[model samples]
Target: MTDLQIGNHLRKLRFLKGEMTQAQLSKNVGVTRQTIVALETSRYAPSLELAMKLACVFDCGVDDLFFWINLEDAKSKYSSDGQ
Candidate 1:
């Protein structure tokens, strides 16, 4: 099976949103600045509630922030024949 990874566009979103700081976003999401730093660096994944909170703060959908990435070659693994 391919390794599924979660990725985000947090830093870019923050910059697009008037260069919002990690401290500011942390406060808005009721988390520590370190948590924001971890999230921006992809060192940690947010809980579902936290994800919703972040989306609410940014007025955007969760999908707009996070996405899935396959670490391995997907085409070579999962075949249409279900092999």
Candidate 2:
């Protein structure tokens, strides 16, 4: 099975949003600055509610903020058999 990874554009989006600070975003989302750091570093995946809140803050779709990355493609080449 392929390893599915969650990726985000939090840092880029934050900068685009008036150079918003990590602390500011965390405050808006009712979380700690560390949480924002974790998000920017891709060390943590936000919960559904958190994701929604972030999207709301940016006035964008959730898909615009986060996405799925197939890690297997990055790590090695492989083929899947049709089932």
Candidate 3:
């Protein structure tokens, strides 16, 4: 499994926007409710298209919803070679 960690701030935004249901958001984004659940739980990483769709739904930038943890970098023993 990938060690990357992604945040689902969209869920918070959706909640703020009249407590929107995942099903509704899913329909707007052309995805299944389970996809929304996975996204909210950070168990799945959406594609660029899905990310953009979600951003549109939340009325926010993709960066505002998802972020990379860079776990490998955090545990790196040596500086990266500029190869």
Candidate 4:
């Protein structure tokens, strides 16, 4: 079985929301813009409370915003792209 890694669709959600900036989303979520950046880049995983807050801002459920991917899938996707 593959390990799980958390991922998010924050960038797409922000774009759908009138091209909302990272700063705007962070402010609405009560977090720093860096946190929003990190989440969008998959460099960070939000706490449950933060996830709920983000979902609220997008008017969606947390599961719709974030998801667990198989680590092997991530590795292959990135590695094959030379990332």
The TM-score leader among the candidates is 2
- The local distance difference test score of each candidate is 0.88, 0.91, 0.86, 0.92
Native-to-model Cα distance after best TM-score fit, residue 6 in candidate 2, in Å: 0.6
lDDT of 4 by residue, 1-83 (tens): 77888889999999999999999999998989999989998889999999999999999999999999799887899899974
So what's the TM-score on candidate 3? 0.76
Per-residue lDDT of candidate 1, residues 14-82 (tens digit): 998999999999999999999999988778989999999988888899999998877575655666449
Q: Candidate 4: lDDT of 45?
A: 92
The list of candidate 3 runs beyond 4 A from truth reads: 1-3, 70-83
TM-score of each: 0.82, 0.87, 0.76, 0.85
**Candidate 2 ranges beyond 4 A from true positions:** 77-83
Q: Tens digit of lDDT per residue, candidate 3, span 1-83? A: 65668877867888898999999989999999999999988889999999998889888899988988766775563455533
Q: Rank the candidates by TM-score, best first.
A: 2, 4, 1, 3
RMSD in order of candidates: 5.9, 5.4, 6.9, 2.8
Ranking by lDDT: 4, 2, 1, 3
Model 1, residue pairs in steric clash = none
Clashes of each: 0, 0, 0, 0
